[model samples]
Target: MYNLAKYQKLKNKINRIERAELGFFPTQIYKLENLSARYGVNIYLKRDDLSGFSTFGGNKIRKLEFLFGEILEQGAQNIFTYGATQSNHALQTAIACRRYNLNPILYLVDVIGEGIKDPKANILLDKVLGAEIKIIEFKENEDEFEAMYRAKAESKNYAQEISESEDDYYLIPPGGASPLGTLGFVNAYLEMKAQEFKEDLNFKNVFHATGTGGTLGGLTAANKFINDDIQVHGINVSHKDDSYLKEVAELSTAALNLLGIDFKLSDRDIIVDNNYVGAGYEIPSTRANRAVKIFAEDEGIFLDPVYTGKAAAGMIDYLEKGKIEKGSDLLFWHTGGTNALFAEKKILGNLLDNHI
Candidate 1:
C-alpha cells in the first residue's frame, strides 16, 4: 500500500492534465473465478475493453481522451494519423474527429495486405466514418515501423499534393502511442489504484499486450508515481527488442513530465517479453487462437486475436512455467481490440473452434 497523501497528490496531478471526455471512466474490474481455479492463481481483469463512448469500446478510447484533447485544443482542421489497415487507433481517431467535425485522414501501413482498401473490420469502420486513407505498402525488406516512418514522411508529401495547409493537420503516431497518449494509461493506473484500495485488492503482477508502447508507458508511469512494486508484464503482440523497452521507459518518463510529476524511468521499471508474438502482428497464431477459446469458454469474455489473445497466451505460458508463484494475485489489463474477431480471416486464424 502507498501513502494516502502521496496517492491523492498523484491523482490530483493526473486530473489536472487536459483530456477530452471520451470513454466511460474507471471501467470495472472483476475477479475471474473459474479462470483462477483453472490456472491456480487469483486472476482479475481490468476491463478497458468495455470503455464505452460507443458500443465499439476499446482501450484506444483512453488514449484518445488525451490525444483528441490536445489535438482539438490546437484547433486543427484536419487530423492525420498512422497505423495498420485495420488499425484500432486510426478507426477511433476517425470517430473522435467526426465527433468534433474535424476531417480525418489516415496514413496506414499494411501489416497484412493492402489494409486501407481491404474494407474489413477497422478499415471498413474507417470507411463508414468517411476517413480519407492512404495505404503504406511494405517496400521489399522494410518492416512495419520502417513503413510507419516512411508513411509519416509520405504524409507530408500527400498533404502538400492535396494542398492541405500544414497548420491544419496533426499527425499522431500509430496506436496513439505518444507521450500525451501515454497519459491516458497513467490515468488508468490511478484508476486501478483506487480500485485496489476500495476492494482491498492485492495484485502482485499486471499483464497487458504491448504494440506501439503507449499503454506500457502509462502503466509504468502509474507504478512509479505511486511507488508501487507491481511487476507489470508487457507481453508483446509484435516483435520488440531491448531498444523498444528503453523507448517505452522514455515514453513513460515523458508522460509523467506532462503531468508535472518529476520522475525518471529506468529499465528496471519496464518489463516486456517478446516471445509471444505468434507469427507477427496481424497474424494470429495457434497458441493465441486457443487462448481466445479458453477465455471465451471460461470467462465468456472475447479477447481479440491480434492483441489481447497474444497477451493471454503469454500470461498462461508464465503460469505453466511456474514463473509466477502459485496463489499469487495477478491482474490482466484487458486493453481491448475485439474488433479483430470480425476482421479478415487471417487475423481470426484460430477463433473458429471445431465444435462451434
Candidate 2:
C-alpha cells in the first residue's frame, strides 16, 4: 500500500541513474516452520547471506551498489575508506572497487591482537582484493579518528606520495550508513513487500542488527511510505542507545523525502535492544553463541558473531520474554556475516571438541 505512484516513479529514476550490475539475484525468503511452531508465530528468514558478492556474502553489497555508482559517475579512479582491521565493509569495498576498475586505499587502524596474525575472516579477503592498506594506531573517537584521516588525506603529499590523486573518491564509515546507502535497504523493503504479497502473508515484526542505524531507519521509513504496519526492530550491535533514536529519526525522514511520501514518524516505530551486544562491537557474547549454535543445529543455518547471531538472539529473547505476542508473524533479516565465524572459531573450540 505504499504511495504506489511515488514508489514507481522513484524506482524508474533509480533504474535509469544507477549503474549497478546484478551482483546478487533475489536472496531467498523461506518460512522457518520449525521456529514458527516453537515460537507460536509465523517466522520467516530473509537470506541476504546468499548475496554471492564474494568470499563472504552480506547486506553491505546492497548499499555498495549505490556508492560505487556515485564513485564511477564522479570520474573517480581511486577510492579511500576507513574501518577496523577486519571490517567487512572495508573488505567488500575493496572488492567493489576492483570490479569497477578503481584503486582502493584502505586506512585500517588499530593493529591489534586476534585480528593481526589470523586474517581468516574478512581481512583475508581484503588482502586478496589488492587494496593498498595503511595501518595506523588509531586511539580516539570516530570524530577524532576521522579528523586525523582527513588531515592526513588533505596533506599535499598524501595523494602525491601515494600516487592516488589522479582519480580519487572517498567512502564513508562502516555499514555504509549514509542516505545513499540507506536507499539500498529502502528498496529492499519494497522487495520484501513484493515477496510478502506474492506469498499472501503479512509479517508483523521485522528484525535485523542495528549497527550503523541506516538499514533499520531506512526500512522503517520505507514501511511508512508503503503504508504497512510492520514493526522494524533493531538489535544494537554497538553502543548507540542515546544517539540511535535521533539517527533513525533523521534518516527515516530522508527516506520519506526520497520516496516522495508525506508522513511523520515517531520513536515508537523504532525498537532497539542493547542487552545482547556483549562486551562491545565485534566481541562475541554468550547469548549470541547459544543462538548461533541453536540455529546451526536446528535449522542448518550459519550466523556470525558480529551481526546475525546477535540479531537472532534478540529475536529469540523477545519471544521468550513474551514481548512479542504469540502467533505474530516475525521476520528475521540475515544480514550475512557468516565469515566472522571463522575468525572466532577459537572461541568455539570447546563445543567443536565436544562434537568431535
Candidate 3:
C-alpha cells in the first residue's frame, strides 16, 4: 500500500538534491490491453521508451538527469563514460553532454567487433552528437568486463593528458550505475506511485531488463522506502555473477542513504531472473526476437532485441510457466533500446527471420 505521508517525505528529501531537467516526467503508464487478454493478467507498461529528449529515449536518460546535474554543478568540462558500441547509456550520456555544452568522451568496448568499421545505430548517433569516441578493441580470449576495466584505465590516462585537474572532468561508470545516478530511478519510482494513486491501480509485479543494476537498485530502494509490496523483478540482460545481486543491494542501500531514508536493502529484497539472457549480451535470441515480433504485430509497440525484447520474453515465459499468478497485475518497464534493431547483423541475429 502507498503511504501519502511517506511519499511526501521521500519527495522532500529528493527535492534537496540537485537534478537537471531532462526527460518528461511521469512517463505514461497504461494497460497493454491485448497482452493482458492473452495472458489472463492485467498487463501495464511504464513507457520510459517515450521518455523524451529524443525519439531514441530509454532508461539511461533518467540517470543522466541526476548525473548531469552534478557534472554541471562541479563545473566539469569533459564527461567520460563506458559502454558497448551500441550502448543506450553511452548514447544518452552523449546527448546529455551535448545539451549541457560539455565535451562527451566515450570509451566504448568493442562488444560487437563487426560494427566498428562502419557506424550504425547508437554509434552513428554518437558521432552525430560530436562525442569523442574511443573504441576499445578486445584482446584474444578477453571477456567484456576485462575489456571494460581496460577501457576505464585508458580513460584515466586520456583524462590526465587533456585536463588540468580531476575537477575539470567527470567519469561516469558504465551505465551510470553510481549512487548519484541511481537517484534518478528513485525519483521514477516516486512518480509511478503518484500515477498509481491517480489511476487506482496497484501493480504487484514489475519486469524490466537489468544491465548494470542502477535502475533496479533505485526501484528497489524506493519500494522499500515507501513500504510498497511491489516485487521489482530484474530480468538479466547479460551474464552476471553471484556478486551482482549483492552489488545491487549495496547500491539500493546507498541511494536510500542519499535520500536520508534509514532503510537498507538485502539480497532477499532483490529478485532477478537469469534464465532469459539467451547467448550473451547484445546477442539476439530466438525467443527474444519472437517476443519483439509479437509486441509489434499484436500491440503495435516496438521492442529492441537487446533489452526490452528479452525482458518481454522473460515476462511471457513467467506467464506460461505459472510463475506469475493468473490475473495478477504486472507492469513491464520498457527501458528503450529499439535503436539496436538498426545495428549490425551480428547483434540482430535472425531477428528478421519469418519463423520468429
The best candidate by lDDT is: 3
Q: Can you give the TM-score per candidate against the true fold? A: 0.95, 0.87, 0.98
Native-vs-model 1 lDDT?
0.86
Please count the clashing residue pairs in each candidate, in the order shown: 0, 1, 0
lDDT per residue as tens, model 3, 1-356: 76678889989999899988789877999999999998899999999998967777989999999898899999999999999999999999988888888999999998978746789999999999989999988999999999999999999999989999999999999999999999999999999888887998878999999999999999998888788989999999999988998999999999878877788788888889898999999998998999999889879999999999999999999888888888878899999999998999888898889987
Over 94-132, each residue of candidate 1 has an lDDT whose tens digit, in order, gives 888887898899998878884544577888988888999
Q: Which stretches of candidate 1 lie over 4 Å from their true place?
A: 114-118, 160-166, 353-356
Candidate 1 residue 98 Cα shift, in angstroms, is: 1.4
| Poorest stretch of ten by lDDT in candidate 1 | 158-167
Angstrom error of the Cα, residue 196, model 3: value is 1.1
Candidate 3 lDDT (Cα, whole model)?
A: 0.91
In model 3, where do residues sit more than 4 Å from their true spots? none
Candidate 3 at residue 61, lDDT? 93
Tell me the deviation in Å of residue 74 in model 1.
0.9
Spell out the clash pairs found in candidate 3. none
